[model samples]
Target: MYQPPHFKEERLDVQHALIQAHPLGLLVTNGSSGLIANPIPFALDASASPLGTLRAHLSRANQQWRDFDPAQEALVVFQGVESYITPSWYEAKRETGKVVPTWNYVIVQAYGRMRAIDDPEWLLRQISDVTRHQEAGRPEPWSTADAPADFLAAQLKGIVGVEIEVTRIEGKWKVSQNRSDTDRQRVAAGLRDDAHEEAHAMADLVETRGAKS
Candidate 1:
């Protein structure tokens, strides 16, 4: 991930939390086609291993899964809020005119061995967990059981289950951590005023992570 020491996130708990917060991961595999990346929403089973396991599904028609070898490694990229940091926000920029624009973001890369599942029951369970997690706070939550059995069965048949046994995980929190406290605060303040939701999110992360350091 090309993370500098100041930007590296070494906390396991923090990395896991980021996955939970941003469950949509970019699953990447290298095969005869070179490389293919699929965006998939995953459910994490933290108890499965020290680094945790990932559960997702892809369309049965997707050839990326078929081409990938289970013995080889796959990478799941989880990205959180990101915002553009303007030099205009920095006090040092005005003092020395040396600062340039940068980006503030959080990213986690999970490396693991992936196994494909064809069992309908296991696929149903994976769908249920991920659905429940996402639908928790909705005004009217939906469940797999809400659908007709035959319809649900047919739906499951069209997709293939994916399970990843995580071997390692890396987190990078580039939330203005390299800047001084004053500059970090300034960046956060600027982000807070931005219209984008992720900008506001990055502002909070900048403040939170900086406080920890």
Candidate 2:
């Protein structure tokens, strides 16, 4: 996380909001198995600690859980709106022809001690919480109790729960903030004209966040 002074985001609530909005995090750990990374959906407990706590489950067969080193910290990266910016979209490109292409994105990185929990009760609760959070706004929300008890029990046996009490977190919002006002506004307009939803989201960020910066 090479953070420039202008792009650094230190607010705890902002970091947590990004994690909650993008729950699928890239879990990175360095252990006996060397460097391992997995994309896992996590549930955040903001009040669990001063920073926050992350709860997720991994397949029992996944070696990352077994490879956890208590002495080391694990990292989870949550990505939000992201888009590629073209120099053609910048006013500076026409004014001085000095602009180059760059990427714009919002991301959060969290670090904490990683541990695995093999208890069935904890796994059940972890899964249920994650499921409920994901299904909240759906018209037909499903629940863990919808499945047969035996089937649910059998399914639970195949996974292990993991907990991380966040010790450090960093957020980077690179949304054309470094550009001049005119250049940023032109970038946002270009992004909004793109067809992808993510680009549109990035356009909004560029306008709001760039203005603030």
Candidate 3:
């Protein structure tokens, strides 16, 4: 991850928060199968390690798990709010016509040694934890116990659990922080007016994160 000083997010809590909010991460590994990437939903246990621990499951048929190399580290990328920033939104565009379009986003990258677990007990716990996290806000939440025992057991046989003790993590929040105050404010206003959920989220980031500039 490129780290420009102005955009770096160094707080561990902030990094973990982004991962929890965007649990679906792009798991990247380089092993016998070469570079392979899969989109997997993960559960983060902040207390599990100094950095954190990531728990996820992959279909038994997915070769990525089998290709895991203990000698190499794995990377999981979590992407948060992202939106396009138009030059038209910058006051500098009108003042000097020197502004260019760019992107505003928040993202976190976690790197750690990969471990694959085939034990049924671990798999059960991994799935339950992930399920509980995702269903937390729902009016009618579902649970792994809701399924028939035999059926759930049979289904669990088809997947494998993965755990990664995150050793390194990086966060970048590029929310118009490089722009001048007037330009950043104008960008936020334009994003808010777009009336889209993601754009509005980016607008809030611009207001809060860019304010530190």
Q: What does each candidate score in C-alpha RMSD?
A: 1.3, 1.0, 1.0
List the candidate 3 regions with Cα displacement exceeding 4 Å.
Answer: 211-213
Query: Candidate 3 versus the native: TM-score?
Result: 0.97
Please say which candidate is ahead in lDDT: 1 or 3. Answer: 3
lDDT (tens digit, per residue) of candidate 1 on 1-213: 797888898898999999999999999998887888999999999998989999999999998778887778999999988878899988888899988898878899999988888989999999999999999999999999999999999999999999998998999988887788999889889988988888888888888887434
- All models: lDDT? 0.91, 0.92, 0.92
After TM-score superposition, the amount by which residue 57's alpha carbon in candidate 2 deviates from its true location, in angstroms, is 0.5
What tens digits encode model 3's per-residue C-alpha lDDT throughout 71-110? 8999999999999999998777778998788988899999
Q: lDDT per residue, candidate 2, 1-96, as tens digits?
A: 999878899999999999989999999999886999999999999999999999999999999999878889999999998898999988877889
lDDT of 1 at 189: 91
Runs with alpha carbons beyond 4 Å of true place in candidate 1: 211-213
How does model 2 score by TM-score? 0.97
Candidate 1 clashing pairs, residues 3+ apart or interchain: none
> Candidates' TM-scores?
0.96, 0.97, 0.97
